[model samples]
Target: MKILHVDTSITGPASVSRKLSAEIVEAALRRHPDAELTVRDLAAQQIDHLSSAHLAAAQGTAPENAQVREDIAAGRSALEEFLAADLIILGAPMYNFGIPSQLKAWIDRLAVPGATFRYTESGPEGLVGNKKLIIASSRGGFYGPGSPAEALDHQESYLRAIFGFFGITDVTVVRAEGVAISEQARATAIDSARGEIAAIAS
Candidate 1:
C-alpha cells in the first residue's frame, strides 16, 4: 500500500491541522504496517499557483519556450503523484472560510480534465479509481453541520466535491474547530480530534 500525505499548513509546529494530520498518518500506518508513505509539504516547497502558462500547457498549446514545457511537466508530475497514491491524507486549514492557496494550487494541478476527470454521457466521470481519503481540517470557529457558520464551510465541501468529481467518494474528515476561540476550546478540539484519530487508527 502507498500513502501520500499532503500538508498545506504554513504555521509549522503551531498548526493544529498539521498535528492532527500526523496523528492520522500514524494511525493509518498502524493499520497498514507495510504502507509506503510519501509526504508533500506544499507550503514548505512553495508550489507555484496555476498561471496562464499552466492553462496553456493543459490545453496542449504551449509556446516554443522551454519554461512552458518545464511547467507542463511539473503539472503532470503532480497529477501522477496524486493518481499513484493508494491513500491520500490532506492537512488543510481554513483560510477566509476556504482552503489555503497552497492546497488550491495543488488542486489546480490535479483537477485536469481528461486526466483526473472525464465527461461521460451520464455526467462527469472521475478517472481516478477508489482510494481512501482522509482530510484533517482546522478552523478558527465552529462550522459544524448546523452551526451558523456552516454555510461558510467551503473548505471541506469544496474538497469533497472536487475529489468526488474524480470518483473519490470514500473520504473521511476529522475537523478541529474553534481553534482560535478560547484556550480551553482550542485544547479541547485538538484533543477531541486526536481521540478521533486514535479510533480511526485502531
Candidate 2:
C-alpha cells in the first residue's frame, strides 16, 4: 500500500494533530508492514495559493514568470501525489474555527476537473473513490455534536465535504477537541483520541 501522510500544523512539536497523525501512521504501518510512506509538510514547504496566472497556465498559457512556473509545477506535483496514494493521513488543526490557509491551498491543487472529479449529466461525480482518508483533527475548543460552538466548526466539516466531493466515502476522523480549555483537558482529549486510534488497525 502507498500512504500519503500530510502535516499542515504550524506549531511543530506542540501540535496535537501532528502527534496523533504520527501515531495513526504508525498504526497503519503496523497493519501494512511494507506500506510505502510519503510525507508532505505544507507549513515547512508551502504551496503557493492559486492565482489568475495559475488558471492561465492551466489553459495552456505559459507562466508569466519563473515563480509562476515553479508554483504551477508544485501544484501539479501535489495533485499527482494525491492521485498516487492508496491512503491519505492528514494532520489538520483548527485555526480560528477553520482550517489553516496552507491546507486550503493544498486542497485547491487536488480539486482539478476531469482528474479528481468531473461533470456528469446526473451532476458532479468524483473519480477517486477507491482511496481511504483518515484525518487527525485537533481543535482548541469543543466543537463536536451538541456543543454550543458546533456551528462554528468549519474545520472537520469542510474536510469531510471536500473529500466527499472527491468521491472518497471511507473517511475517518480521530479528533482531539477542547485542547485549549486547560492542560488537563488537553491531556484527556489526547488520551481519548489515542484510544480511538487504537481501533484503526483492528
TM-score (C-alpha, index-matched) for candidate 2: 0.98
lDDT for model 1, please.
0.89
Q: Whose lDDT is greatest here? A: 2
Please, what is the TM-score per model? 0.94, 0.98
Off by over 4 Å in 2: none
**C-alpha positional error of residue 120 in candidate 1 after TM-score superposition, expressed in Å:** 1.3
- RMSD values, in order shown: 1.5, 0.7
Maximum-TM-score candidate: 2
Model 2 agreement with the true structure over 1-202: per-residue lDDT tens digits: 9999999999999999999999999999999999999999999999999999989988999986999899888889999999999999999999998999999999999999999999999999999999999999999999998999999999999999999999999999999999999999999999999999998878
Write model 1 residue lDDT over 1-202, tens digit each, in one string.
9999999999999999999999899888888999999998999875678777766666777567786677667667778889899999999999999999999988988887888899989888998867989999999999989998899999999999999988998999999999999999999999999888877876
Instruction: Assess candidate 2 and give its lDDT.
Output: 0.96
Clashes of 2: 0
